[model samples]
Target: MREAVRKESEIFSELAEICTSPGYVHAIASLCYQNNILIYADKLTPEDMLQQFARDILVRTEVSTLIGLACKKQLNIDLPSPEVIQRYIDKTDSLLKEIHQSMMLPMEYIFDSNEVSDHNFNPFRDGLVLREPIFYSGESAYYFQYRDLSKIKYEKDNDWFLRNKGFSIQQVIDVVMSIQSLQNDKAKNVLRGLFDKNPSEWTVLSAYKFTAKEVSDISNIEIDTVRLVIESFVSSIGMDEFNSLDDFNPKNAYPIIQLPEDEYLLFQIYSLTQALYETPFFWFNDDKAYKNIANQHRGEFTENFSAERLKLVFGEERVFSNIDIYNSKDQVGEIDVLVVFADRAIILQAKSKKLTITSRKGNDNSLQSDFKKAIQEAYDQAYLCATLLNDKKYKLVDKSGKELNINREYKEIYPFCVISEHYPALSFQARQFLKFQETKNIKPPFVMDVFLLDVMTEMLQSPLHFLSYVNRRTSYGDKILSTHELTILSYHLKQNLWIDNKYAMMQIEDEICVDLDLAMLTRRDGAPGSDTPEGILTKYKGTVFDQIIRNIDKLEHSEIISLGFTLLSMSSNAIEMINNGISELIKRGRKDGQHHDLTLEISEGGLGLTIHCNDDHESISRPRLENHCELRKYTQKARSWFGICIGQKVPRLRFGVNKEYDWVQSNEMDELVQDLPKPQNLEGKNKINFAPATRQSKKVGRNEKCPCGSGKKYKKCCLKQEWRM
Candidate 1:
């Protein structure tokens, strides 16, 4: 990758020079027009011109076909066919005309001015002089005159630049080929150098100093040859008028092109090269020795890269690489990268084998076969590692032979196959396989998620966000438990001491049966025929058993039992709501004088309550209670029951039930109350008054029972009233 980056940087430098040169741009534009490739030659970048020329070359099949036809029609004559000769002559004449036009076109120039000058004022009148320094703004165009040079600055948009309308890639190719066809080896070499320079190194003044001996030395060409090429190039492009080499040194006349400092330039070059060549150009010319080394070590490199990326994402403490799972007798498997987040573990298997897709027929067969093999190997390795890590009996060791402190209590394990390439079709197949496994009750030790190496690196930066993303794509069976669900469950589990364990268990079993009956009945238009309650229980149990079993070892036995009860309570509440809705519908129907029969039924394959109307047997209402929105609402409500039940927080009762045998007031009771004994009159015996006592009585403790019949503490009862009396 580093080598590729370097090569592309060099290539872009060269192209940038050609792109910014006004003479080269005009010459290319004329060639493009002559070749019938450039519909509009304005604002054309070198990249665009190359793309247009390639398209033109691909489109012109008649030229090659005609040449072949001429070859076949050759007869033994002093001169070849006149028609062929005329065709050739026409092509030559067109090329010459294009060249002449390119020379005649005025060159667009860019100049930098440190000082500003107003167009309305005469600079000479104020004794002001402006110096023109050649400036390159990475564009090609015709002559441009700034109306207000004062307004221009070196900033992005304010910089002086010129360009015609953009040209297509084919036009650029045409321009290159046109330069090639000039048959001037020196000119070709010079053009190649310009094309090779970095974008930042492209400057109008520097491009003109091609005759220097230093340039010849750097380019490995003779001085005379370089000077001859420079002279020919300037004359061809009509730049002879600007030549100042006769009176001034070439080095002093033009500024040296500076090397690019922009870090983003490398990426730009990579993108441009990718656009021009189907692959990076350097890859085609890769050294065999280096290629072999790269291929051999690619796996190790990818593994390290992935490890570092995960470390950056999840913290160094949370990520481990080159983990070896082993039994006492032998090594089991190796994990490329392991990331532990909370109680969840993400095990990654990195496959660095480069797989290619060929254009030949039946090529995909081999590709698919290799892909499947790679996927199987990655999955197997990941599964083995996860299983070992999750089992207490086995042990894991790092590369340095240090035993890892493996936590065997992981609640979730995400096995991933990280590949260098993005193969959507293969990913789809992997997803389908996982879905199939889920349906078959074949819980594959871990859910395998396939990710491109680049994508995995990006996702690792925000692990929680990535997990949520995976949760949303739950169809692949790689969903992580949502934090919301975990939070609710955790809060309830912590408060398990307050839960009525026995009552919860009993209620949960009954609720499960009731919920299953109602759910199965409402699911279809009939009663569950001969299916026993036990059988229905078995079926529903299967649905939640896998989840329950996976979590069983992670919690205490009591907690697991509590969790079962909570799930049952939630399920029951959801079913009860549906049942109540159905009952309301039935009541409304009956009030309207419509005869409807509601029955709970269970079939061997089904369990649900069904409603049937006697008036219309064919048109029975089967409320679609299974709509996801309604089901989710019920599920959430049911889930909330865990918090409510464990917390011992009962909601206020909205309705009351009446019982027989209660106290009642009657006329006889009123007469009996009048005949009850009356206390002796205290007024007749309490006439004596005593002087106020100076001493207070002994204080009574607040906890002591009150003498008053209110059964309250003495301080809270009549203790205060005694002082007032």
Candidate 2:
């Protein structure tokens, strides 16, 4: 989107001028505090103001973060000239463009929507989709997919940085507990508040510029310890200290300014936040062995934290950690975290590796290597575990050396690679450098830092809602490009994150994550999002559909996971169509004085649902639902079928039947279905209305021959007033 402005000298000179100014550090630090921490995440400001300020604050952070590294002098954004400001804006547009061009054309993608049902665990990573793109020497043409990523968010959650730049929550506890003086819970919170405050307005910067004694007096920590902690967090530098991006490492970084009479002050808002978080780790680093232990603990904490997070999404009973696979007593591979739900599961492998310092400075080779360790290798382990699990000949065991009981036939396994730290440029790095194994019957893994995972489990609490994300993410992630994982997730939460097959590419802007950031921040404040995730289940919140979703894992049957998947796999329109059909069935049942049921198949032989309606709870019976669902399954030749029993009076779901899968042709069953009422025409009941993303006057490709039989590009042939319609 931007012309490459290669005048590095002019750009750096302008940036240096602004960064070296007296107010640049304080200005950004203040913006970071107000835009992020001051108000509740839910929009308290006017919409236009919020959007504009979000963009402005984002600009401030990128520019300020760059200069904050070594700019010990006061800094401000008052540029030497308008040309300098224009040049800075141009560079940012280039980064935005880079975020959008993240798609690679794979040779093929075969989505087997007829997924397996409960208790039938098939151990493969669902590798039918290719993760690696084929090298094509010849020319190729691609279409443009539509997405809006114009949203902006300026901060990572403060809690994320608290964990030593990369440790998980439990490790956070251990790390903070070990370093009592600096990072213990109260000290950490108070330390940041010492420098930052949420004022009524942002017109005047309101952060405290205080001495060590004033800070200690304001906080609960003892004055002597507070001085030592501040000293440990000291990270000021001379003009020569930084020359490139690589010099900025949060572990040893925070912008500060030297005041009068030999006193130095922390950049109040975000800089102090960084200093506060990174101080604890530095405090323990005085002991080499302790530091080493802490380092190893990082990986362990990631694994445990991932398992805990997964447990939150899919119940604790189904989530297993450190499950070892064996080939006749010889340990083969281990699953860091395995979450099972009937016939579907998610396999996760966590890595503590982060983006190397050199990588952050713009070294391509270092970036690739860092990604390989932090994301690719984790996927490899998870994929291997999935493949082995698919092989019935292998054995599974837990970390306790006991044989792990994994009897269900898992038909679809979503593999995930989780990182210990929030690696910047993560989404782009994945698209650019990650090389997935070319295999069959497996899906591409989604790599994310623990920060996103934590938010995901919190927002999408229902099992089906969470599973729907995995299903959609694995299906369309490669084709969609964005700057952050949260950006993509935020779009999904807002609008289901769907891309129509009509387009070949989609570019998601950063703008969509703004509301999500507010929601997440509100959730952090304990109000839990005045406007959190508004995804697939939002419309059906208290309906029986919602009840089914809430009880997906709670159902006493083995096929609940698959049923949840089947229900979630349907479009929102499809769900509404089913609801309409259920109403019709209820009316028909009242007229006929019998329990009336309907079967709504989402696709020809994909996932389908059978809903039985009755006037009262007494009229609801498992055998009746089971009979109707089984007959429907046999007739439709469906891969998976679920039965829901609804009591008309209660206007709610009374109970449900577990999903049935793996249909077999039987003459007797065929005869039985024939004796039943003839199947109704599915036109109205099965119709799913999903609008086209974009409508053009010319339906043909811009490069393809025109539809009017003119052998010219559609754009050229259709260049007329009538075509505009």
Best by lDDT: 2
lDDT of 1 by residue, 119-174 (tens): 44322111001010001011110001010110111112111111211322233222
> What is the per-residue lDDT of model 2 for residues 1-725, given as tens digits with 9 covering 90 to 100?
43344343344445555455444444444434444344324444323225533544443334444445325454342323334433444554454233222222222212233544434422122211111121101101000000000000101222433443443233322222223222223323543554464432222222433455555555545556544444544554345645433355442344344444534444333334433333444444665756676556566767877888788877778899888888887888989888887667788998867555566544546656777888888888888888887787788888777876765466678888887554655655666566676345467787776667877887787677787787877778678876567777778887776776787778777677666665654555333444565566477767656766666556634555556666665567666676666666555555555555565665667556667677533332555566667777787777767777776655566677755568899987776566444334333455533222232343567776433222334565443313543
Residue ranges of candidate 1 with Cα displaced over 4 Å: 1-292, 357-360, 422-460, 474-725
Please report the candidate that would top TM-score against the real structure: 2
lDDT by candidate, in order shown? 0.34, 0.55
TM-score of each: 0.32, 0.69
After superposition, the stretches of candidate 2 with alpha carbons farther than 4 Å from their true spots are: 1-6, 21-49, 52-56, 66-208, 236-239, 249-252, 256-258, 261-268, 274-286, 437-441, 526-531, 534-537, 556-560, 583-593, 604-607, 614-725
Q: How accurate is candidate 1 locally (lDDT)?
A: 0.34
